[model samples]
Target: MIGLCLGLAGVVWAQLPVSSFTLAWDHTVEKIRWEEDYRLTETGLVLEEARVRGNGAGMEIPEDARLEKGSWHYRRPIPPLQPLSLGRTPQAGDYQLCVEGDCHALSHWVGAPDINEPAIQLWTCTRGGDAQ
Candidate 1:
């Protein structure tokens, strides 16, 4: 019983590291618009910020959305955000930002579809600098 409890504690502690999530529009001129960062906690995932770039603007997440079973739940109604499904899937180079120790790629369809917005593509946590 004690051993089982210890193992469970270790698992919980391992999840303490903060992970970032970003939503950016694929544009021809600017490339990216808004990028958001989220941190994981014992209670749930928290939104750190939603950064808008160079004359670009977007709707902000009303509150911190908890990550439940790999899905995010916001407190209030949010704007649309999801991947484009014009039939042909995008290649890695089309939307992937690669760097040392980290890579930001378009997020797969995870979580509820009804609330997912189609205008913004997801980005993984980056190590250093902007997505190139």
Candidate 2:
């Protein structure tokens, strides 16, 4: 079975039995909400869609983005990534990983990161392989 793996420093920390999830966070500079939906595949993770409440600084809404309610929605046609890297910092707050309809802080799954650590890696892995 395919699942999502959370790791740090090349070591797998947690394997979630989920095929799809949403990663949400606040823009560090803009202080606006941003969310990305992703699904796990045999080869890697696929980003389905992305939404941002407001754009500023480095967060610019795509020209094809449509205004839906109070947010801008768009789809990025990027190829599946083997491993997705996420930056972590106390100042930016924790990332909310939403599965099904429930959302939880990423730290809840892998514990808090060390100050020296800079990023958390996410990718798809087979249950019997690198994932436990």
Candidate 3:
């Protein structure tokens, strides 16, 4: 099955069995909620949608953004990403990766981040006997 590979540094540590997932987190500076939906494709990871609950510094609402259910939603026409990087910090809290209707902390896949390794990398991968 196609899923996501979670890695630290350059080594893959864990693989999640999900074709699509929603990543939700609170802005470090704004303390507002932000969510992004992504789907795994043969080419790479495709960003499907993005939403922000109350914008602040660095969270600019796009001209095409629509306010719905107290959040600004919009989509960007960007090419597929080979790998996606996310910053990790205790102060910012854990990143919630939701698949289907369930959500889990990203640490659940790869464990806590080391002080020296403050970032997590996610990419499309196929899972069988091993993640590739």
Candidate 4:
């Protein structure tokens, strides 16, 4: 029994430098979609450059950042989740980890449609920049 206990202890001690949920995220949503409710589970976010995805659109955005989707123009805020350990499994709510602040869309082309509606899209660090 003692030997088994020591083995377990050794295993735990072997895995060092493990961090807890240190990263959290936040977001503000301004969209017109029906699923007003969403979760944060996909972290690799980017700003401006957005492409169409399955059910809805997906963008690489930062933590606590806001983005617009669909056409309803519904507005809401998205909160970040706790940081998942290196070996831990992440859930749906664990994906919203990114930098904070506004992520604006690219400037319109010359003589383009004038929506006048500014939508802050989601984004993440592309070059491992600051996370504040």
Candidate 5:
């Protein structure tokens, strides 16, 4: 009975709508390329870009900095996932870590169109003059 209860709880938690989600892509050459969060709402999508400042050999982007004004757009919404891997790539692409909800990481893009939507389409960044 305890095992069944835990399984049901897991299922409920998985179904709960995620308040917000983040996606990060680390580029050593650029120190930071793409690291941002997208919040879901009844209206639409809200995008917040990471504001990083140099801190010795490391970096720091404060929570206040993340609260800086971000843009919002309307797009086809996707279901919330609990640390799920959205997509995968065979070889290393421009991004080191392509993350989604709850630290779900995707390394490469095999060109599979499973999670390819307008929301992900607009949430892109340019590195060294090249679009990723």
Candidate 6:
């Protein structure tokens, strides 16, 4: 039926666009709690810059970008790209937070663990239009 066809078209339209992914740190090893914010790029419509707040230190993502401090609170202006990543080694304590966006299907790891080692959660993604 036309109704089914139209519904499918709208679903495709709302899907995420092409995106870039990168990782950054606070120049520290252990992160107490980290929040990384991503925003839209001007032309590329891709994920360009990411801001990470961890261990009292903050940084703009891409590792080679820049360092800034104070506040990991979520704000407007979704980062460019479809996905981005922030890096940190979790402390021995417990912390809870969100990684922004619809990135849930993405995986997490620390230092790219060996196949045999237990996977450490260091990265994540919001649902990619299919989390449900």
Q: What TM-score does candidate 3 reach?
A: 0.91
TM-score of each: 0.30, 0.93, 0.91, 0.15, 0.32, 0.24
lDDT of 1: 0.30
lDDT of 3 by residue, 1-132 (tens): 787888855467888778899999888888899999999887788999999998679998999999999999999999988788888866667898999869888888777656666888888877741234
* 9-36 per-residue lDDT for model 2 (tens digits): 5578888889999999888887899999
Query: How displaced is residue 102 in candidate 1, in Å?
Result: 2.3
lDDT of each: 0.30, 0.87, 0.83, 0.22, 0.32, 0.30
**RMSD in angstroms between candidate 2 and the native structure over all alpha carbons:** 1.8
How good is model 5 by TM-score? 0.32
Tens-digit lDDT track of model 6 for 1-132: 000000021232123332333233324444543444333333222333445554333433343444556534433355332222222223322222223433332222112323442222221222343211
Candidate 2 vs candidate 4, TM-score winner = 2
| Residue 70, candidate 6: C-alpha displacement in angstroms | 11
Report per-prediction Cα RMSD to one decimal: 14.7, 1.8, 1.9, 18.8, 14.6, 11.5
Tens-place lDDT digits, model 4, residues 1-132: 000000011122111111111122222232211222222223521122222211223433334433455322223333432221211112211222222322211121111112342211222211222111
lDDT of 1 at 83: 17
Clash counts for all predictions: 4, 0, 0, 25, 2, 20
* Cα lDDT, model 2, residue 102: 97
Q: Write the per-residue lDDT of candidate 5 for residues 1-132, one digit (tens) a residue.
A: 000000111221111134455556544444544455555443333554443323223444443442324422222235432222333232323332223434543323322223332111222112221111
Q: lDDT winner among the candidates?
A: 2
In the range 18-97, model 1's lDDT, one tens digit per residue, is 24333333544445443444433323334554444333334433446554544344543333221112111332122332
Candidate 5 regions with alpha-carbon error over 4 angstroms? 1-16, 28-33, 53-101, 107-132
Instruction: Work out candidate 5's RMSD over C-alphas.
Output: 14.6
TM-score-superior candidate, 1 or 6: 1
In model 4, the runs with Cα more than 4 Å from the true position are 1-70, 80-128
